[model samples]
Target: MMAAVATAALLSGCSVGVPDPAAPSNPPISSGPGTPTITPGHDAGAVAARDMPFSAGATLAHGVPVGLSEDLAKAPQWKQVVSNAGGASRYQKSDGCQVAAEVRQNQWPLVAADDRASTAALFAYLDPTVLPAYLKPASLRWGGERGKPGPAVDVLVLERAAKPTGQKAGRATVVLARVFGTAGSSVYVSASCPTAAALAAARADIAQWLTVVPPG
Candidate 1:
């Protein structure tokens, strides 16, 4: 019924669609034939480096959902460059730091299901192996919060990528993404940071900013 999750910015308009997690080019580790009963916690061996916060909030609440609320792009570090309607947007800073939401669906079945497999699928969608060398974490982890999860799935993933062309490529380009679902809606959110400090701050803000509409 519950377990720990192991964990996109999209552009709005200009014909940008919700970046489908299934669209990645690499082959993924299949969820397998049957659902594996994975306890809602992380094993030190399978999940090395369990240093992040345990549970994000007091208890699970449904209905309310999360989104890219902060105008991080408004600040000088990240200036807004593109804006469109229908749940897609992008913002970038001078040093190639940026935040974006590639998918924001108010009601999506994939996320609302909240199955461990679904969560795993979403978390593995970006597959960190393909990230540029020297940018990926020396160690990776996927377990956080040990509890039974609801149909509303909430997943998070941390990764790194090369800065946009012509910017600083070797700098720490951290990518943080969240798959949030509650009540009856779901969203895929992501942000890229130029430094570990920036990613840390951004993760806190994003985790705190999520919302879910409680059912009546």
Candidate 2:
């Protein structure tokens, strides 16, 4: 169920992931609890600490499980750097299940001066026409199909760090072209729920996920 949502979000648009502009700059968000300091650097201890243990949701159309977690302490040095640099918060189930995950605070610097305006800019920047056949559909519907989404989730883009310079991989680009970690900083938020009311319930967490430190 959750995997479907995540995959669909990806298929519909670029799912958030490690900054990859050349790749699709989109991956799923994590559902956990924690308020920790997030900066951009490396921390091996944090990687090991982030061994998230939780349950797994159904696989998506592409056959991928959703809801994963890891101990931030055990994360690799570079993983920690990207996570904090992106201002992330991992999540997991209290149970012994191993479907852990993390929803890093949003951090894409190249957001347009106006939040709403930036959303469109990102869509255009990651133009599906420019992507390969496989990515076209998702990039075209990056947020959602014709603006319609499943009852549980809403497809919207939010502004984060100020835009950067150059079309360099992680330096800067148009919109979605430069992902948060890789370069231009700005991203879309995919919030999913099982029901309309439940979707509303998830807003608080979604808001938290959007909070990112202003880019310098």
Candidate 3:
């Protein structure tokens, strides 16, 4: 159920992972010819990490599961540079933008079972701690789609900094989502963008490119 919502949000190109009937809609931006693509240089360390195979009983990192999806592995324009036996993988582009995702079996009981509940739980966890550490106060907005049996929650965070005199301002955006499954399994996905425009252009495709498979 959570996966379905994430998939829909990605396919629909919605800014938020889930649709909000009351939220104002915006037109999609056009990516004309010569649009700069994110292409980050490869890291040898990351390449060595990808040599590890995904295995069962792996632990989650930053709420993401451990394992590479065929969809993501085969996705064009991205390369998996870091992977470990624990199921964590990092994808990078030439532009320094990157994404990481993973899957793991939950060790705790299902406290937040659906989207609404899971969103609440996630907000509580991220609001006082995670968001503040990364974003300016009141910079995060919450509201997307409701979760199903295993609800999926999505959040987007953006931070801006004034660049040195004469240089363009710097901006960064991070997109995160967690999808729950039966038997206490969950998949976490996240991406880091150097600019808001890059985040907007790539978030949906990157999210959609991931395919989560829970361990048996």
Model 1's alpha-carbon lDDT is 0.38
TM-score of each: 0.42, 0.28, 0.46
Candidate 3's clash total is: 17
Name the better of 2 and 3 by TM-score: 3
Write the number of the candidate with greater lDDT, choosing between 2 and 3. 3
Segments of candidate 1 deviating more than 4 angstroms: 1-66, 106-117, 125-155, 161-171, 180-182, 193-216
Instruction: Give the worst 10-residue stretch by lDDT in candidate 1.
Output: 1-10
Going through the candidates in the order shown, the clash numbers are: 26, 56, 17
Q: Order the candidates by TM-score, highest first — what do you get?
A: 3, 1, 2
Candidate 3, residues 27-58, lDDT tens digits: the string is: 45677775332224523233222211122112
Question: Cα lDDT for residue 186, model 3?
Answer: 37
Comparing 1 and 3 by lDDT, which wins? 3
What CA root-mean-square deviation does each model show from the true structure?
13.4, 19.4, 19.8
Instruction: Report how far residue 6 has shifted in candidate 1, in Å.
Output: 16
lDDT of each: 0.38, 0.27, 0.39
